[model samples]
Target: MAKQRKIIHVDMDAFFASVEQRDHPEYKGKPLIVGGQPNSRGVVAACSYEARKYGIHSAMPCSRAYRLCSHALFVPPRFDAYREVSNQIRDIFWRYATEVEPLSLDEAYLDVTYTEAFNGSATLIAQAIKREILQETRLTASAGVSYNKFLAKIASDMDKPNGLYVIRPEQGEAFVAALPVGKFHGIGPATETKMHNLGIHTGKNLREKSLTELTERFGKAGQYYYNIARAIDERPVRSQRIRKSLGKETTFAEDIHSIPELTAKLLDLAERVFESLSKQNLKARTITVKVKYADFQQVTRAHSTEHIIQLTDLKQIIPLLLEKTEAGIKPVRLVGLSMSGFDVPVLQTHQPQLDLALNDEF
Candidate 1:
């Protein structure tokens, strides 16, 4: 018999911002912006739902957000506090399932298909977990329950500030089909604009296009669009999935036309690339620059280096990599930097995750 799939995506409600409000009761019911200072060219970390009502959002310039909602309470980041709560929440997760994969400090996916709780319906488990979360954390979380990772992750966002949303198998594709194209996971501003220009303004519009049309329009993302539009996602809820690569991508709010501007963007991208990869010990041999033009056509340029890349090398070679693709790209809508082909260590490596998984075996 084919095993039934049961996955849950648990996302903390306004993780950082909520933590601040929880710690300081005065911050509750008021607009709060948490991150670096507004004058320091800082961006929004996370804002209270109250601030969201004022058009303030994460990643917005704190200065601009200030202009929009001057009364909003502003505070510097408290990573230490958030990290502490994150550990507690994770402990709560491990009690339910060992196959837990964290998307970030505040979100994770749990596949309870084979857990002791499996005999129960996913919705019942979802409710049980939600009640437990409220009791333990005194914080709200939104949950999505479904058969696969894709839908479950998206479903979790359906209800916010303490919600449990379930998409039963029967609803499946029909549910996704009813959603707007902009609603698909990862359809950021640039992709949304491209889809609108391509006459795919909603999920139904995207569905009307053939697989070939989507693939031609959005490159690799097109495949994801086609399948997810009909809720056909099959990806497993992988736990401690060895991250093969860590990379960063950027989408410009405005398209770039000039060489100097493009080059500067590339440098900025490289800096971000190095910053992200620097935190991990993973070493990679290839660096790839991904570009999407204003017209939505996408292409990549990759070069293999004999030695593993460091921040210095990434910054130094970014311009050269741009030059290699100079003939093909223009008026860029988005640009991304990625590295791959990690060199595996020979001897016994330290994967603390294996010990955790083994401990769960008994």
Candidate 2:
């Protein structure tokens, strides 16, 4: 028999908003929206649990969130604070498991299959991690323990703030069978809509379809769907998932079609991207510039240097990169800059094809 891997998914509840509350006790026990101001054109990055009662959520427009809860406090994100907390949590995770895959600043999956901690019991390790987090950060986290990443992720979300849940191998199928298709982590709104149209509302409904039939409907993702429906996700908790690229972008409230204006935005984005790169201690040989026009059209251009890039080099290369696009002539709505072609030596490297989105800011 194959070895059953022990995995744990740990997620900080209301990460950004909770950090805000932790720093400012007055914000606690009240609806707090973190991202941008209500009058701004940006969206909510995250909101407190109290804010969720008002039907507010991350990615919703701050203005719309304001309309939903007029009295809610809107706060800008402090990425530095969140990043620090993330590092602290990561340190806590590393104490128990060596193989940890960070999904975001506030969530990660830990493979503790070979760990000597808690007698190799994933449940005990999760409990210890959560306790350490609360004691160290004064923050709460929810954890899910299972034999696989998919089940662990699902189990972690089964409970809310400061909760722990588990899914044994034997109970995996029954647990997934009763789950709503939309509740699956990888199934987004679009996929859920398609699944619902096909009468695949629950895992049970999904398992009823043949792999060929699903492939005919869902394309390549059909194979993934078929396997997950059987609670059989074979993907490992990969710790060394290398960084593909690093970039930053911003959307404007109004479009501009002037070269001078676009140039200014490009410089700002370059500076921001460079700052991020420096913070991560990364260097790149390639710099990419993305432009989005007011009509929802987008374009990108990239230039590679002979050696690792510097901020000064980026400044000169950005204007040249912009020349590859029609940004000045076309009303530009957003601009982004990214640095890839990392200097780190790896076993294998794959440069992702650039697909600049029409409406996406980054």
Tens-place lDDT digits, model 2, residues 267-303:
8888888888889888899988889887768999999
Q: Candidate 1: where are CA atoms >4 Å away?
A: 244-280, 286-304, 310-341, 345-362
| TM-scores for every candidate against the unseen true structure | 0.75, 0.82
Give the RMSD in angstroms, all C-alphas superposed, for model 2: 8.5
- Pull out the clashing pairs in model 1: 181-202, 181-203
Best candidate, lDDT: 2
State each model's CA lDDT, in order.
0.78, 0.87
RMSD of each: 7.0, 8.5
User: Would you give me the overall lDDT of model 2?
Assistant: 0.87
